[model samples]
Target: MYLFTACCVLCGEKVKANISLCEPCLQDLPRISCCCYRCGLPLKNQLNDTLCGQCQQSLPPIDYLISSLHYAYPVGHLVSQLKFQHHLVHAKIFAQLLLTTLQTHSLYHSIPLPDIIIPVPLHKKRLRQRGFNQALEIARPISETLDIPISTGLIRRAKYTQAQSLLNAVERRKNLRHSFALIKPISAGHIVLIDDVVTTGTTVYELANLLKKQGVKTVGVWAVARATHHYK
Candidate 1:
């Protein structure tokens, strides 16, 4: 049961203590009922193909990917507020939703708990402008709940590129190329990348490729939501 009373972040309605939104609002959040296990893309027929066509052709560097919701409706609104409006509490809301998926999703049982959780790094300029990396904030609760260390310095965002959302699939890949540099050594064989939202999966793909070259045996992703419109 909820502890006390608080204002819902989404609706400004009264909610139980420690809850982000009212029950109705929470229930209205968009969800991904079926998706590609490799890239978190929503799929129409999981019974026919577990992996999407892109995944079947060339596997992403990610060993597994999990996104709990579609980047739609109030969920997208929440993410926008968190990213641009400096609403840090939205990070906690994202963490709580992702944590629930990690515990209950079918894929959860197939992969070992990550040795370290790496929130996708932001370029210095972006980090300075935003004042925070939303992914890192979202990852904090998960790290504490799962008892996994959050590795902040293992990778660095070396290039300041255009925002992924502003580009098409090809452009997104090109925008992120060599953007991340491994600045620190990591002994953890199994690691997971955390992000606020995953669209084309280019960012995580680049990261996972880098990790693989560095002898990281397994790379996975945990994202709050997935944008399925563009994948190339």
Candidate 2:
């Protein structure tokens, strides 16, 4: 149990909640309803493959991506606080919301629940500065709730790249190329990539590529939020 004193980003009222943002803020968060099923980008209609325009042109390495909420308004501010302001506790709240969203979404039954939850790895330098990986912070509670095993050391960030926010789509892909390596056998089972947010998805795509190379069959992207509109 935790208490949050910060004002809600949506209604701007001081309130208590599991996360920093209040219930109204959470209720007001934007979501992606009209998006490709495979890659999670905007789409007018669901196709056979359910891949977006960019995804149809050249598929991302991952098979599918599932996001809980849109990366906008209070949700975006929550992410910024977790990443930059060091409010890592907010990740638990985000994970709870993710679980609730999954329960309501039909997509939940389409894929097998991952045998293991693997958080996107952070470079040693960044981990040292932040004192924690935001992805891992979110993954902890999710694992506990779902009773899924979590492997922290199985994946490693090979090197640090420039901020993904500063890079264009092409640059983002190039930046994350060879960025993640599986240090051990991740077990031959469904894998769920856990992260705080998905923008370009280059990070999760590369990780899925690495996982497939490591002998994992099914890989799915699970993020707290998805940036439907991004700078890059």
Candidate 3:
């Protein structure tokens, strides 16, 4: 018999099977301590109130947002490697981290669990080019851990739009208009939308609008990372 060993992707330290992170790397992962509860944008001050200035001025479409990490430092590097390089090991690490955060974070623990998880869909052309939907890959482990079924066929990207990271907030919103459509009827009361990262939140907002129209009362977002500011 052969024994297999796994090492932490970040530190190269030995780890148990089925996990990519050692204790140190897991503890060192960039976490979002304070953020807007509505959109998950990192905040400067730690206050009792969860909404940021922008969220207070204009409420987000989604009922709530829960993100595990900030899009900075090593977390951003890991995401880039996973998304562009197809390093699926990073996806597993992300999913595991997200699950741990959801289970332990007081804010997330208080919120009601979603009935089903729906990963943000990729356009067919982009999906083919990438060979996999990063969101879907990230969602699988979360689904298994939470015992919630993931629904991928309910919604689809009807139009291929430019990547959100490449556009400003205004352009991102404009680009995503009418980009997604509901393919089949959804019966879930509360649905959680999963994505790798939330930059401008335009993509999730557009998709949430479609899900809300289908009578999903509570639409929440679960992402690996949340961008504090808009990307250039």
Candidate 4:
């Protein structure tokens, strides 16, 4: 069977589905590398751990970091849409991609499935304004696929700091230093911290630090995208 139809595409390329991006534009989305196993940092030489020197010198509070895509190009555009445009449907697609990537990696198999999933909490003010937390939207699909329990009230944003986008590393660390706190006692267990994107790792570090202090075991970070920066 054959069918013919005409549809307008963003790039003026004919597309079967009605979508904002054409096939070529979608293909231009950047993918993450598998170099540094611990975090997704690009690697230079063979190393024992998949950790870059920057992470090694000043380690992230979480034990492991995994990202589905690099924060660049069309991927970054999609992230912006999901975050700012309220296109929450993108979260499921992003989570599925992450699941597929994780399933293929041998290293991911041995790690224990997180006992619980926690999205980076948003302050009440921001939550009310945005009408939703993007992190929670992403985490919901992941939790559904992995069959892991999710706890929204476990983590709270006690103080809202200046947007991380406006801060440098040192300032970012200071801003996030005391931003997070546990709402109630969380029992010790493997926990996965979910967020839409990670740049300097300040926010996740603060959350991981708090969880570790609370005696949680093996905290790992799972985010949709990570900023690509060369660690010299």
Model number with the top lDDT: 1
Each prediction's Cα lDDT score? Answer: 0.87, 0.78, 0.85, 0.74
lDDT of 3: 0.85
| lDDT tens per residue, model 4, 1-232 | 1122233222556755434345665566566656466655645565425678777776667788777778876677767777778766666657756776677655578788899999999899888878888888878867887899888988899997788878788888888878898889989589988988888777888998899988997888888888887321
How many residue pairs clash in each candidate at the backbone level? 0, 0, 0, 1
- TM-score of every model versus the real structure: 0.94, 0.88, 0.92, 0.85
Cand. 2 TM to true fold:
0.88
Candidate 3 residue lDDT tens string, 55-146 = 88998789888888888889888988888998888888788778977887666667678899999999999999999998999999889878
Candidate 3: residue pairs that collide:
none
Which portions of model 2 miss their true places by more than 4 Å? 1-21, 44-49, 229-232
Encode model 2's per-residue lDDT on 16-70: one tens digit a residue: 7555567766666786666677776645555424667676688777777777778
Off by over 4 Å in 4: 1-27, 44-48, 230-232
TM-score of 3: 0.92
If both were scored by lDDT, which would come out higher, candidate 3 or candidate 4?
3
The alpha-carbon RMSD values of the candidates against the true structure, listed in the order shown, are 2.6, 2.6, 2.7, 4.8
